[model samples]
Target chain A: MKTHTLSSHIISYVLLFCIGLFLVTFSIYYYFTRSTIQETTKENAVALANNTVNRIELVLNTEERIPEIVAKMLESSFLDRDSLIPFLKSILKNNKNICGSSISYEPNYFPDKGMFYAPYVFRQGSKIRSTMLGNENYEYAFMDWYQIPKMTQTPYWSEPYFDEGGGNMLMTTYSVPFYTYKKRERTFSGVVTIDISLEWLTKIMSTVKIFKTGYAFLISQNGTIITHPNKDYVMNQSIFTIAKENNQPGMRDIGRQMIKGGGNFASADFKSKWHPGKLWINYKGLPSSHWSIGVIYPESEMFASLHQINIILICLIVVGLFLLSLFTVKIIRKLTSPLKHFADSARLIAAGDFNVQLPEIKTQDEMKELYNSFSYMQKELAEYIVSLKDTTAAKEKIESELRIASEIQMAMIPHIFPPFPDLPQVDVFAVLKSAKEVGGDLYDFFVIDGNKFCFAIGDVSGKGVPASLFMAVTRTLVRSISDKEISPSVIVSTLNKSLSSNNESSMFVTFFLGVLDLATGELRYSNAGHNPPVVIRGNGDVIMFEKTKYIPVGLFEDFDYGELSLQLAPGDKIFLYTDGVSEAENVENKLFGEDNLMKVIGENVKASPRDLIHNMEVGLAEHVKGHTQSDDITMMTIVYNG
Target chain B: MNVLVTSSNDYTIVTIEGRIDATSSNEFEKSVMEVIEEGNTKIILDCSGLNYISSSGLRVFLIALKKMKAIKGQLKLCNLQPVIQGIFDVSGFATIFSIFPDQKSAMER
Candidate 1:
């Protein structure tokens, strides 16, 4: 974020920036426009002033030449009085402004060279100075233009003096001094002069235009108004008297500076009966003629449009702000209202209210998707939690039942140590443990008759209470058969036949039974598709009876069971177990296979049955540490005394 | 109200003809202001033909006299009617402004 002045930080900053931009643009435009107007006006003034001054000079010069032409004609020596009179009359008829014309002579006169056409004459005889009207009434010395031209030495334009006697006119006269031949010397002669009315100076300012409320007037180089449309300045009155008379402000100061100040446009604030405390002025001086012209107009009228624009701008800003604020409020409310509802629903969801629902939105936008997703997640989460809880309860009940069934299954066999203490030559220990879900892998050993002992270990194909029940039945049948003095193979055959009878579910067990003669140290075992039993020789060498079998018990009818016989020496051990014992796995998925189990038993073959069992359990445990037990494990060991 | 003054200074007659109403009062004040700006504080206002006086019109004379007094100069008001003078008296402006009966007397003072 850029730092800015405190005042610039506002929502209205945008509006103000826009307004400022517009004003700058407008001011630039107005500046160029005003400059163009002023330039055009100045061009017009210069053109008009120059052209009018030249035209007026030309007109005056042309008119002044009239009387001289007539005088020249009348003074010709060849003209008689009759011809002269007629010639003079024609001159008057053609030139209306020439009330009269004259030809005169005065001796010893030297008129200015440029002042008159004729100059430097002494008195000479036989002159032709004449006037068409009153031709012979007076001597030429008494006439003003005639005498004045003869006495001067240069050309001049006279003041606009009044003339009452000749034509009662305010006029300017043009004169010419002339010479006549006398005794071979050029003698001075009076001048021939004619008057033109100054009031007829329409050429001075030709076709000028001034504003309706403005005035244009002439001022002398001395700041005296020569001619004004107002009749008050008939005499040579300056603003000195006007200021004192009117008691107006700055009138005297302006008059004082008018002559010295080079002509230019200027304004003067004045208090007067005409206008109070307000003035608008413009002035220009004709440098060649030493005459100035001025104009006045009001300043307030110039900026009237600016004031109007200000009002319009203010109104537009007000309306624009009102609309903008209104839009902001409406849009914010529309955008956030739905979000507020969703927030409330989310809080309810947090409180575990599965049935909580949000308001249905009409538009299928992101917000709607969010609301739908929330609802779906809530419903799924509730169902998952309920299912999880129910699963946990069921698991606990099943495990509890498995515990009881496990105990009962163990009780149905001989798990007691030292079952026959009197028979010190015989040692046997067995163990059967069900998995958490309850499985049928059991081991049992008992004395059927006097010197005949029966031992069996079997594994049910499945787990849970069904497999345990099957194990109970199989154990009972094995004990009964062994007591009936049947061979081990016959016992396995009978057990399979009895288990397979009416078995609709196709359930089965892998059974291995053993029969031993105490005096001869002979062990007979029958395997029903079970893992082979491991035997240890008298030299402490372990051998697995990896014999083949036809089928498992309860799998087929009339199946022949296989038997393996071995005579155990006094220090030899025999190990029997189901596949569960060797296949027990840990989290590392390493099974307690037959190789490791055989090594453990062979090394401890000289130990008692309990010690051998203990060594086997420890070896399995060591091999299968940190691993999940995949199946129930059962192991049995027996020691024979020859 | 209108204000008028007719005076003669150095043999030049200064006839202040016409009304000096509230509108013209500004011009009246402006003339006085100019005079003071020029450092000419000695002034005589001959109000002989004055018909009416208003607050706006009198303010010019009051300002002029105040300015003249600060500059250690004098401003004299000559000729006054009872009504015009009454306004001056009520505003306590009579004590501050110098009054004369005629232009000659103002010039003399």
Candidate 2:
């Protein structure tokens, strides 16, 4: 899980939404704007075509009206040939648009003027000149202006022509027939005509403003191009020829509709020697001569404004989104600064630098509250750790003191295994173990007067320091008393009297004191309410001494103690122990009772005192495996080899 | 070991139970001495509930007996289990202390 920060998430989502919105809005705007520009360009083309047609119509209408008015004046009062020549010259002089005028009568209608008598007046530079146009080289009856008006008895406009005589120029003629009334019937007299130079019309068509790379062209009713941006097409190519050359049937169809004298606007893709790509053509028919005025604009040029606006809009949106992202990132960084500092502090705290200084936050917000909580937690943890360390130090001091006390207590007991090595008559060994740091169990043996060997093993009533002290007291009392008294009973009785008199704490000890007479192989022992010792004979017979039990010492003063004696042969051993051995418990809580103790002693009947004690300890250790010793264990073995 | 000490008139009845080994013998002694220290020196040890007694346990009873004699007070034993009576009889404890079969006789003494 790679994760983004909270502020980064916000910035990403906001930017995404903004970009999406911008795209949607821009798409709609572009579509409508493109359509609007297309429609506007189309309308502009149509308006330019219409305006060009109106100018052409005004010039053609004026030329046609002049011929008709002149025809009516000549018909009302017949003019002589000379007067007619002046009249035509004045007409050409008065109208700047008219290039020339002519009148051609029927053959032989005027006897004096021949069968084709027609006079023409035209402008050469600034001068008006007269010429006879009805000569054999110029056939008046075959001219389209003369023939059309004479046959229809109406006014007509001729196709543009380049005249080689009678005022040489490219021109279009408008003709009207004059008739005479005889006996309520009209008779055709002559054709009156006016020629308009097409140069001015070509100039007017070229002046149309249809953006750059756009042009206007004129097509006659017969589909011939009259005026065009390409000079080669003028008077040379038809609209249908250009359409076929461009391989566009749609352009041909527009040409057909245009030449039908019906106005229309259309667009088509036309590629020819003169034009390429898609073009928009708006054709309008002129009412005067049925010529169609067409305005053409390339689609690229027409939609150029739309493309420019689209690019601007896209650029603006991209820049806007970029700025938005920058602002979002800046705000997010500023807002999450506190969180970053908090995280750094948290990391330091986890690394165990609890006292690390946290960054201060002045804003009274959740971050400040969180900082305060962390600071408090840091202080509390430091205090708690300090107190815990102090408590541990105190506990360790007590434990070490107890260990020293245990050491001193162990030192007080007789730890030597072989006491009285010089006496070859007896060997003795003893071991003591405390359940706690210190214990009450004790064992001691010493030679008295070179002939009497006195040994004692005792169990004080308790454990630990108090019992240890009591054990030391009991051992001292027994040692001091035994030095003055040879009898075991006398020593214990005196020791009891000393301990019981001042026993305010009610502590006591179970003691067995024995005096061995080496010369006689006799053992005299006092048992003060203690478990009786076991004696093993040389014959492998184990005997438990069960005689003369007195109350334990340190319990009462002046209590008479009893003594028992046993005669031991050579190789006989006596085993002494506190109850810790017999009462030692195993994992099952079963005590190592006296039966087990006797069984261990009986098995090692031929063993020395050291071996006997070792065997018993091993047996007890095995029986109490995985269990704690609940009491003090003391064992002593004395072997008398007599 | 647990010692329950109850006094009736001049005599204190100390009921002992469980094992009075080296570790618990101190507690037994302290409880019995507390009764004696209160001037109830005419003590009777009821050993019917006493299952085991160690050498240290015997030392407490001996100290109690000596203290009673010094005070010129009597100490008696009653309701002793067979195992305890065997220990008393073999060690010649029966000779030193007055023993009875029941508490009534020990109290009458």
Candidate 3:
């Protein structure tokens, strides 16, 4: 029985639908945006790495070309060892990128000089200085820059090293072995070399940046880190050693790939030793120096903006959903407000105010149809109530008239307890009770010729107004025509003849008339279609009048009736009643039959007429036992005294 | 009250059953009147199933008799229960109406 508003139901469904749609749209947007941002990040990192590597390659190529030009001069014998010093000085002075140059010969190749003789010229800040780079204490012939080119008899670039005695800085040398024509064939001479300071490369790598905590680094072909943001790692560690320290097998793989002159521009397969978390790296190898340059992009910093955009998008969707719910509730409530008014009006109508005004609905919808139905029902109820009121009033009027008619009919009979108060020779009492507002039973008595007493009792065949009227007419006919000389049978026969003449309704009445001889205690009675009256003797013996050759009154004209006579003793009582007494029903539908009536009359044989009728009334009441009276009852008793 | 009517070449038989008091007299009257209105000259009211009759029911029988007499038709009754026969005897209806003990005896009339 608990109820919720339609508005709440609609709002819940709407919010659910909106949430589903938002989740689908947001998920799709998130997927494409995340992939697009990742792609752009990769492309941006690669471009930055490519730019940095190209610049480093361009500078290294120039340095390599300068050394090749000097080696060719030495090979053609165009410049002797005397011109080589000035030549190196001029080359160092012209190219600011070159920090130092040295030309080393075999230990005793000149034969005139002692064991070690190598000419070196370098720029010491703003001065052009020349000195011997190798002596008894320092062996330049055994160095990588000198020995590798001489043994390989080809040009080579050495791994970067710190030159403590000569340049006093981190530097890499490109050495080219010279050739001498001996017996018209090429013979290996000492090496011609130039050194470039790695300080500038280190400075450039330190300046390279991708984002916060993102950096660039360079590793030489031997897998030794040359220039890096962390200066300590540059000279002291290789890529493999850093990978080992960090326990990153992926870094080792990248290192192996890089030293083989292989790299990728979009692989995020490395982590910086100096930083924690995943990093995207774009690494490229320099063609001239065979050094790998890597640009590190810490993933968190690289996608920080993308994460911020996603947070903002989610917040906007949440706000949008909330606003949608609020507006939907408001709109739904506005649409359904008429139902509330209808409910109020319906309650008033149910409480008997059929004329209560209903809210008007203009829209052609279900609510409008309901309004029409309510109006129609109200009109119908009002009309029905009005007609019911009229019907009830008419019925009440008819009932009141019947009650008055019953009173009039009761007045027509002699209700005075002692009919012959002055004549101690006779006693008579009677009673009549109707089952409805009017009764069909009648009892009457009068003194005829001042010595003869005439008594009559009759029952109309039906009940209600028609039967009551018939009984009244029969009683009137008996009273008007009976006289001292008329016999009981003749009086009844004449009444029947008069009643049946024009009786179109076919109603009839049962009649009994008696003339009592007060002086002789003789009773003469006629029965016409009526229950025979009982006569109780002074000896308490009960007897009934025998059957007569007559039908009830108003049945047929010219029907002859017969009479019976009985002599009563001084204390004898003659009890007369309609069938209402003998046929009175009990709750069990058993009638108070003639036997019980005759028994009661015999028991009260010595009682007065009034006492006899009272005893019979009490016995009948006891027999009925509160059962509804189904017929009118009349009883009359005549006690003759002689 | 239930009234069943059957027509034969000689007469129409009206079988009335159950108690016919003030309430059921109208239905009894209606059934007999319908039979009389159908121009049936002879009607045999079978009282075999009639166990009780009130004054109002007696009035309906009287009306049916009067209606039949006015039309010059015959209305006979048969198979009256003893109690009902006593009522008829007291009311002197046994003298005015032709009564028979069974349907076969009434059909011979």
**Each candidate's TM vs. the true structure?**
0.43, 0.57, 0.70
Model 2 CA deviation exceeding 4 Å by range: A1-15, A74-82, A111-113, A135-137, A150-154, A164-168, A272-276, A310-330, A352-355, A365-367, A387-642, B1-109
Stretches off by above 4 angstroms in model 3 are: A1-5, A65-82, A86-95, A102-121, A141-194, A198-215, A218-303, A322-326, A348-367, A395-501, A508-554, A557-642, B1-6, B13-31, B45-58, B77-105
Interface RMSD of 1: 68.1
The chain A TM-scores for the candidates, taken one by one, are 0.49, 0.63, 0.68
Across A325-347, the per-residue lDDT of candidate 3 in tens digits comes to 88988887777788888888888
Place model 2 in a CAPRI quality band: acceptable
Report the C-alpha lDDT of model 3 over B17-90, residue by residue, as the tens digit. 99899999998989889999999989999999998898788888888888889899898999999989989998
Top candidate, metric lDDT: 3
Query: Per-residue lDDT for A1-642 in model 2, tens only?
Result: 428877779888998898888889888887888788888877777777777777877777767788888878877766655799899988888888888888878777778767677788887778888887777777788877788888877788788877766455668888889876656667887888888888898788778868777888888888898988777887788999987887778878888888898876666646645556777778888887888888877888888877887788789888988888888888878766878787888888778787788877888888789888988988997788789889989988878988998888787777875666688998888889898988888988888999888999888776778888898888888878887899998898889899989687667677899999988989998988677889888889998877555766776688898788888888888899987887789978688888899999988998878888899989998999969888899999888888
Could you tell me which residue pairs clash in candidate 3?
none
Q: Compared to the true structure, candidate 3 yields what TM-score?
A: 0.70
> Per-residue lDDT of A140-167 in model 1, one digit per residue for the tens?
4656556556677323333444566554
Native contacts recovered by model 1: 0.00
Which 10-residue window of candidate 3 chain A scores lowest in summed lDDT? Answer: A265-274
- List each model's interface RMSD: 68.1, 4.1, 1.0
Candidates, ranked, DockQ? 3, 2, 1
